[model samples]
Target: MSTVDQDYQLPGGGANITALPKISLHDHLDGGLRPQTIIELADDIGFALPASEANALGTWFAEKSDSGSLVEYLKTFDLTTAVMQTEAGLTRVAREFVQDLAADGVIYGEIRWAPEQHLARGLTLDQTVEAVQAGLDAGVDDVQSAGKTIRVGQLVSAMRHADRGLEIAELAVRHRDAGVVGFDIAGAEAGFPAGKLREAFDYLAKNFFPATVHAGEADGLESIRGALFDGRALRLGHGVRIAEDLVLESEDGDNSYVSLGPVAQWVKDREIALELSPQSNLQTGAIAQWGNDLIDHPFDILYQLGFTVTVNTDNRLMSNTSLSKELFLLSEAFGYDLTDFEVFQLNAASAAFLSLEEREDLADQITEGFGRA
Candidate 1:
């Protein structure tokens, strides 16, 4: 079966995890394209791919992204974005992204992509956004026709290494009423801190736009601090490195004492959602400081401390995973049960860039679905 059609169950023959409703907050548009779609689109554009076959192309992405450096892992995007330059390519990929999410039982998702990258094919940034929105609408309609419900929004991302932060921020706000929900800055996060895009963040704040900055993934505590202070980020994308601020004081049998630094305290106390992608974190070496495995992920530690932790599949194709698969792996490693899974879903719903009423509705849907399971 395909990855989207794969079923996952809780440990010891528990409920089917794939059947449970989930929310994806940090999924990337350029990172989630289907391999077969890439092959066809590349052929249409006369672009060469590393692998000719669909399965092999998919495997190539997985293998290339497994390199232990975030910079090296991101190089794979050169191929995916190459095929996504035209209106048709963008629309088709956006539509299928939603369908695949629905197949994986995601009720809601926020698709993020950098529009500036697609402009190489003579398409303007605004046109790129419109094309993606059209595809998102088509995907939602298709899901409804299939007797299922799925809602999605676009998160326009600005490449941090580029000089179009303010422009892209305006682009996102301009499409607020259309389908765009939020703004983000993604790319090499270490050197290009959010402070570098202070003008963009200032504009977003003045316009009352919400943002979720990509911090704590390829950078450390200072980058996260910049996201909060300079960017005014409402939620953190892969904010796993905040664990660096936590100091293990002592351990007493079943009791352990830990002290949180100011940054960690602020995030935990304010409940800034951390979009933790397990498999992606492992592959990209995001958790290398702590260890090199899923069990070593700081997700459990942050969750235990009452931080708002939500699970995600950051790059479905590159990681060769689904939201169901990420949750299943966490359950297997941490011995989590239905309750823990439900908490994670509810956390994501709460962190979603939706209004309070809409977020509550999503929480109710999650509660009802998990109750039946």
Candidate 2:
């Protein structure tokens, strides 16, 4: 479409992953801004970025995010978030985010961002949501005008370290009819467990709302357990470490065998989706214990064990990636073909926080597209 097919051959040539229909389950809104857009927004607000040139600013984000420390990686958001404190900035960024996702062939996506982080400009939390919705709506309209349809939902996030979980959860439910789809608790997950927002999760549950918590990435089984029990999360954000519960016995040439402990069994049995960001996982050292390279990721193992694994670009600009790029990297590392790639999309479609009808429609769209590919 944009002369960027995102398709690439594997060691053994076949279909390119970029031409395949994709669903992005874990992309972040604030983390995916264009470098040029950042420069303009920062300029409009009289704000200074780490670099004046867009290319230099892009390099700055990449460098900071790959520092292998969660706190250091998170520092990049400070600059991105700094420019997002106004209505114009929020709307423009949101609209552009969707347009870019559409360009990447992501038919459906869920964008998560913290609203509390955008109120520095005197806008109320509800006002910030409205501004972002305006942008997202514009982006959707832009897609339709281009003869390509893309749908997006906002997973309004409450910074876990802050005490505004209940308020943000209510904000999400208040905007439920207006593009806001789900609730999430993101931020430093090590010290702040999902249980910290027990009141908020309980409220979401009572209202029949859905949540997806950032767990099992910074913390361990206890955090994941809390997300399931306390947060009542329908899906796990980057729940890669659930593989830590997997115990391997042996593997031969033709076949391999392994056993799942209680945690792993429950996750698989319950069919919780894992939003695995391959490159982000590698950069953040999330998979450091397994290996340094992409091949060392537990994604293939989780997929083989019947876990609902979905591919994502947790932060596109910072990781210098797109949904297509992540798929290409995965295929290169794991020999994935069209069928394997389609399975990932199907998994994401099923895990999307959407109505049964919408999910089914998305599944049909994915299935039909993949059929053509």
Candidate 3:
């Protein structure tokens, strides 16, 4: 089943979440490639896949990622990146990625991917970035031609397990005016702390560049601490584990009394946005301490605690999900109405790396769209 065409409507026929305006803050470019596109790109490069057919390949990705292991979940990206080593592959994937987001009603989205992983075809970092930018521009033009509005920016990422943090950071800053909006470090969050890339974060800070670090996913509170204090992260990637710091004191009649640890209190008080991916968090075991189901997630806890909680699809392909599906799942699990959905979109708009004016404009767009929905 391709999630691309899933009919996800709010319960009681309230509203169609897909048609609602959305802002995606933590979507991955490499992770959201179309399954058929991957098959074509892989065939062009003579790369073998676990499944040759598009539907089977999509199922393979979802199965491999659903193994309840972060390392296993990440291995699926190797096949996707293998096909993205050339200019045509990169451009087409990026172009189609935008079209997919626009089709899903994303008003604004930040697509993150690591250039270091795409250098196998003898393309320089700058060339890869330019190719992606060209594709994004083309995608934007196509969207406008269709009488729809969508905006996209790149978040250049450095693989945390690799030693190219400084190089990737420089590349992001170099293309800041072109299309890149920020820098990030992803992959293997536990052993590879953000502090290991302190030099890159330092350089980004010196250049006034913002960063969002992947922490509290395959790691814990200490890792989130490093991302904040050392990496100076403006936001957290799947920081669902930050709930580990909260101590559930007691539950009394539709309410749970909880005590926030220092770190949890800090994140909530500082309004550090938690880019919470409901399905991905379950697949990656990020919320294993809590439970497996979406209802078991600390998202409702964080949201009720006044944390800046935003919904995201970390890997649409792997999870067989869309942002609307995620929102629908949360609504089904938590009994959220259109107003609750509005809050999530507004949270994402505020956390976008856009200027204050642009963020406000996005907020207005979301508000107006939800008003009509």
Candidate 4:
């Protein structure tokens, strides 16, 4: 059976979690394309792939990404990204991404991808955004046509190592009225802090645009500091490593006392949303300092501490997962029940880039969905 078909009885066979309404805040466009689509698109563009058949290609991605080594894990993106440079490839991928999310029971999803990475085919930055927006619009329409409703928005991304931050930020502001919802910085988080895009953040701040930075994943607290101080990020992309800020004060048997450092204190007090992806976090070694198991993940600690913790599927294809599976894994590892699952969904609904009314509506939908479940 496909992974999506595998079902888990939620604490008493309450309901299949996959049928619950959810919000996806951190899914990547380039990382969610189908292997079949890649093969077809590659053929259309005269590009080569590691495998010709769809199932073999799919296994190829899962096998390569399971290597545990960070560099090897990232190599899968090279194949996916290579096929995503053209307008045809980008649109098709974006469309399928939305369709897949709908199938996974995501009512709303914010799809993020870097325009700077799609310039190889000679499309201008503005042209790239338009192409993605077009794809997103078609996907939403298709979802509605299928007798299901799913809303999607583009989170225009600028590569931190590249020099197009300011340009991409402007491109986002320019397309804000047309499907673009927010801004983000991705790619190589070690040396390239959000401060490198100070000018872009400044522009976004002036325009009152929302920003989410990839911090505390490959790097530590310092990178997260740059994201908040420089990017003024409204949300954190994979802020899992922020767990480093907690200093264990004492432990007595099963009860361990911890103190929040300045950074953790600020994040918790401010209620900044942490976009935590369970599967990808383990694969990328984001939680290696604590341990490799999901039980070692700080998600429960951060949640219990009242941080705005939300679950996400960082990259569906790379991780071979969905938001439903992430929640399921967390439940199995931590003994979380339906109430805990509801909190994560509510947190995501509240942190979504939508307006207050829409966020409230999403919360209501989640509440009703879970209540029925």
Q: In TM-score terms, which candidate is top?
A: 1
lDDT of each: 0.94, 0.89, 0.92, 0.88
Ranking by TM-score: 1, 3, 2, 4
- The sequence of per-residue lDDT tens digits that candidate 1 reaches over residues 1-373 is 2335588999799999998999999999999988999999999999999999988998999999999889999999999999999999999999999988998899999999999999988999999999999999999998999999999999999999999999999999999999999999999988999999999999999999999999999999999999999999999999999999999999999998999999999999999999999888888889999999899999999999999999999999899999999999999999999899999999999999899999999999999999999
lDDT winner between candidates 2 and 3: 3
Judged by lDDT against the true structure, how good is candidate 2? 0.89
Per-candidate alpha-carbon RMSD to the true structure: 0.9, 1.9, 1.1, 1.6
> lDDT for model 3, on a 0 to 1 scale?
0.92
Cα distance off (Å), candidate 3, residue 206: 0.8
lDDT of 1: 0.94
In model 2, which regions exceed 4 Å deviation? 1-13, 252-254
For 271-315, candidate 4 gives per-residue lDDT tens digits of 899999988988888889999898999999998888999999898
lDDT of 2 by residue, 228-288 (tens): 9999988999998898898878889877898998888998999899989999988888888
User: Which candidate leads the pack in lDDT?
Assistant: 1
Error of 4 at 127 (Å): 1.6
Which 10-residue window of candidate 3 scores lowest in summed lDDT? 1-10
TM per candidate comes to: 0.99, 0.96, 0.98, 0.96
Please write out the lDDT profile of model 3 over residues 146-166, one tens digit for every residue: 999999999999999999899
